[model samples]
Target: MSCEECCQRRGLGGRMIPVPGEVAAGCGLAWKTAPEAREELVAALEADGVPVEAMTVIELLEFR
Candidate 1:
């Protein structure tokens, strides 16, 4: 169960993304998700006892 896998399973507009240059949390990957789902996502991750560096709301332009 990789980080990417967990996010994918949520099906809440989550995707694997590179960690922004300004932040470092041992891993080079970050989870990108919709702002609306942030609270739910945070609760889930925390409940699972996942090691998270930080939760940030990054404004990204979704390209369809």
Candidate 2:
């Protein structure tokens, strides 16, 4: 899936959520190349037996 796709899957977009840094690994990332690397990370984690799930995205545009 694309980076944006993955982010969307995790409920993140132009939104924010209150969570710890440990969950940062699943934030989909803020890199321009995230789409390229994300799938790999997911695959690697899955191969390593790591559980990954999507997170909730909270709209925070108003807070800005």
Candidate 3:
């Protein structure tokens, strides 16, 4: 997927994972990335012609 490819190309920290339960509804998946990467990521996604619905930043107790 584009998310995975974007991270790999830029060496960003993230992965494709199941969307958190609290979110209303979605494709049941999301690309988890560092909050700091949002801006660059948005640009990359736009360049890649990916339509982004929403992006949220939250603290996770652990991510690996």
Candidate 4:
């Protein structure tokens, strides 16, 4: 999605960032944010009538 669309839909202090090649092989963007904020973020998007049919939920493993 475009930055404008993401900015208008996202609730938290999130921004569209370049997708990692390991995540996907294309010139695409994804929203970067803290995992704890998922609920509020989703709620806000729904409240704003943003269609989230294409949204994917992925758990990233933290390397210590």
Q: TM-score for candidate 2, please give it.
A: 0.32
Candidates arranged by lDDT, highest first: 3, 1, 4, 2
Q: Model 3: what TM-score?
A: 0.75
Question: For model 4, what is the C-alpha lDDT against the true structure?
Answer: 0.62
The reply for model 2, stretches above 4 Å from the true place, is 1-33, 55-64
Local lDDT at 17 for model 2: 38
**lDDT for model 3, on a 0 to 1 scale?**
0.77
Kindly list the per-residue Cα lDDT of model 2 for residues 1-64, writing each as its tens digit: 3434554555443322344345455344432223345566566545555455653333223345
The prediction achieving the highest lDDT against the true structure is 3
Q: Which pairs of residues collide in model 3?
A: none
Give the runs in model 3 whose Cα sits over 4 Å from its true position.
Answer: none
- Whole-model Cα lDDT of every candidate shown, in order: 0.71, 0.43, 0.77, 0.62
TM-score of each: 0.69, 0.32, 0.75, 0.55
Worst 10 residues of 3 by lDDT: 20-29
- List ranges where model 1 is wrong by over 4 Å: 22-27
Model 2 whole-model lDDT (C-alpha atoms) = 0.43
How much does candidate 1 score in TM-score? 0.69
